[model samples]
Target: MALLIPASFGNLAVSRRAHVSLTVSASANPRTFHRESVDWVKETASFFDQDKRPIMLFDGVCNLCNGGVKFVRDHDRNRRIRFEALQSEAGKRLLMRSGRAPDDISSVVLVEKDRSYTKSEAVLKIMEYIDLPFPQLAFFMQFVPLFARDSVYDNIANNRYAIFGWSESCEI
Candidate 1:
């Protein structure tokens, strides 16, 4: 499952030069995808805190996604969630292992010991781990039509870059 920030029209808290400013320069949002799913490859690995906890896979070049990561990190009081930038070795591998299309990198991918999900399914699952009002939204899972739910999620994913702005790929 996944989580969300209530949609709004305020100016984003992200930057436009992107992360590449830390390095050199490159522009153009690459649209071509090379494969169906990155998961076909051998599964990659991740770092754990002293105790074991799952991390999330995200687009590192996306300021909005990164900001979301920070928000999750800050709010997850149990420190139950960690992170994996979608561009990272582990992030890509997890995407594949979870049965998501590599080139389709749209949803917030979660890697538990077993499986993964996309769109509203994934978002709602992420909320489950966070507890409280987030987990409460899980109830919506039973009543909403999948197409109706996913269409909304799809619109948001497709427009995310335009709305949030992106940076060059980064290592953070």
Candidate 2:
């Protein structure tokens, strides 16, 4: 049997064998849907250079989230990732385009050229994009069951503010 799931980026087909695939149409432009206005999309698309870098959306007020972004930046010597606070205009737009609530700041989001990933999946993708050791580590982590990985991610995300504390102001 096969299960069809509709996503903002594309249609996902999951088979009983546990195989899953995503198919995005050629005409579906992520930037067009993620931006409020066509003009803004055009301008920001050029300014951000989305083609060359993946966008990371993080909870700006969460201390742990800020630290994670900082860590990614420090390690990403090749500058493969671009960051935006989930509360920021650009981030909110992307969240909306991805069919997530703008106020849902619990999970880290990774937006690539044609698709988006959240929670543990997002973390793994970000690791793969970063240098050497991380890519090797991410490849190993991929062997872990998705549900198990995401469950752990959710537990930490749900208690992140209490455990790591939150800031009054949103930091980069």
Candidate 3:
């Protein structure tokens, strides 16, 4: 079961186990994942305490997703972000914290400063943390409406597998 909460751009479906105060933007269709009973707020707090850097979660087996992660790693001269595969334990926990199903890999998710950005918002926000020209480019792209940006994003994401291919196993 899920509780629907009104959000700025879309409705948020929060899971019963989600206790963290996370602002989710441009999320995908909601799905439920079974979670073991635990104190989620405390767990997330301790995890973030260990590392303050923002986390980027992606589809580990998708070639395009892996390429994007590599791009961020190479361009992020400051190394301000950490990465996790959406199928990994850490990624699953973060997804649950943000009220997303662990098995849902429809879009890349960025968790930073107690908020989550998904779909096109995650992509642009990621550019902001990377190298110089990308940030400038992202700033300019903000002029485009969210719906338009996400429409293109969804198109690419939906076809990523056929266009970019996928690996048999998760990597990086």
Best by TM-score: 3
Q: What's each prediction's TM-score?
A: 0.67, 0.72, 0.76
Estimate the TM-score for candidate 3: 0.76
RMSD of 2: 11.1
Winner by lDDT between candidate 3 and candidate 1: 3
Model 1 agreement with the true structure over 132-159: per-residue lDDT tens digits:
7777777767369889889998898888
List per-prediction Cα lDDT, in the order shown: 0.60, 0.71, 0.74
lDDT over C-alpha atoms for residue 22 of model 1: 20
Q: Write the per-residue lDDT of candidate 3 for residues 50-166, one digit (tens) a residue.
A: 788889999888899999999999999899899987776677667766677655778899987568899999999999999999999999999999999999999999999999998
| Candidate 2 ranges beyond 4 A from true positions | 1-51
Evaluated against the true structure, the overall lDDT of model 2 is: 0.71
Give me the runs in candidate 3 sitting further than 4 Å from their true place: 1-41
Query: Candidate 1: where is the Cα deviation over 4 Å?
Result: 1-52, 170-172
